[model samples]
Target: MGYKAQFHPGTSDPSKNRKKYMDPAYKLQKIRSVSDEDVVRVLGHRQPGEDYKSVHPPLEEMGEPECPIRELVEPTPGAKAGDRIRYVQFTDSVYFAPISPYQRSWMYSYRYRGMDSGTLSGRHVVEARERDVEAIAKELIESETFDAARTGIRGRTVHGHALRLDENGIMFDAMQRYVFDKSTGEVKYVKDMVGEPVPAPISVGKPLSENELKTRTTIYRADGITIKQDAEVLQMVQNVHWERSFGGFEPFKEAKF
Candidate 1:
């Protein structure tokens, strides 16, 4: 039964005539013999995925296996050395992480990755000294407190505006931005002097009138300090002081005498 060959009307039974179809001598006769004359000429070489190997440049003459990887390019002619500007990709945002001298790649610590991934030197190390810097910066910003030595000052006469104090009193050179205060003598506000277009003193040559001075000076009770000169409008300001004006317009409700 297993060997019985059956014919359905037009079809020959494959089981009974298995040799007729399966024999290599007759079935694969098309590729049985190859000769220089019968050989098909392949115009171009077939690549890796092709089936039949060409005759002209036979499979035996094929070149070596190619590498799948590529090489990295070096920096440009004048490119800066450090990898400080390298960007790293993490979950979402592309973070700019500074590559430190010690480590060539991004830090591998999980804590570092969790904080701000892809930062070469983690946020903690990079930002370690920042708080101290910010604290000092805040102190400087608040130190805009008035200087008592500058009160009742006329044009170019206030200590803060003097080029060379006549009485050796504290002063700030309108030209140099240097403050000769008792605590910190010859203190140069370098930022103000070096910043673009350089900040100028608010009231150096122009004398503040009684009403102008009264209106110009505003006391901030929260800070317990008075702003003598309007840093916004004036340049080369000669008038500045710490002494509270006796009877001026009071703005703050929590102001204490």
Candidate 2:
């Protein structure tokens, strides 16, 4: 029998959320509605309805190098069309953000291909062929993984992952790419990801309540559930650590530590 895949092992909400985020088969819940035009607007990659700029001739026209590996591997749409590489970045809050930087990398690994991702203490970046990147960014921004106030779309000058949220309960951004609307109580992007001015404001929607953020957050804290609460998770972590340490020595020898 073929082996079935297991995403992660845990009983806690955060653990379950992690599994859900890292499962490719799981269709992330769409919690907000942002049009493709608006998504493009915030990214500032290309003008709306503009033809996708290409780096080279299409793979079919150019005739790729004759290699077995090339024949076996299917290229993504953007790659086939020779689209330029583009990037999108997100900064997640430490205080009950739905997903953190490390988890975002894991989620991207499971859910995407033909892309490169990097993680930092405060932010995560995904780079891929332009069209594919735009699609991925749009989905991520509108999905439940994103919270209007907690999740930031920043291409440069990533800040506010550790600082206290503003009075409106939104993460702080030195560039002021996004701002809170007092009347509508929604978050709007007046500037592009790199702090460039957009033609007009684009509303991302209202922020989630603090209670909602806690319930959806994947981060473990003293106030919320912790790893100590799940013995299976703790044991799995310890087992992996022990095995890695043991592997450092002879394979046949028993683990002493």
Q: Which candidate is the best by TM-score?
A: 2
Question: What value of lDDT does candidate 1 attain over all alpha carbons?
Answer: 0.23
- Candidate 2's displacement at residue 128, Å, is 0.3
Give per-residue CA lDDT, model 1, range 7-105, as digits (tens): 111111211122222222322112112121111111011122334322234222444245343123332211211111111111100111111111211
After TM-score superposition, the amount by which residue 5's alpha carbon in candidate 2 deviates from its true location, in angstroms, is: 2.1
Question: Model 2: per-residue lDDT, tens digit, 1-257?
Answer: 99876687888888889999998989999998888998898899999999999999999999777999989999999999999999999999888999999999999999998999999999999999999999999999989999999999999999889999989999989999999999999999999999999998989899999888888988988878888898878878887998876766777766553
Model 2 bad stretches (over 4 Å):
243-247, 250-257
**For candidate 2, which ten residues in a row score worst on lDDT?**
248-257
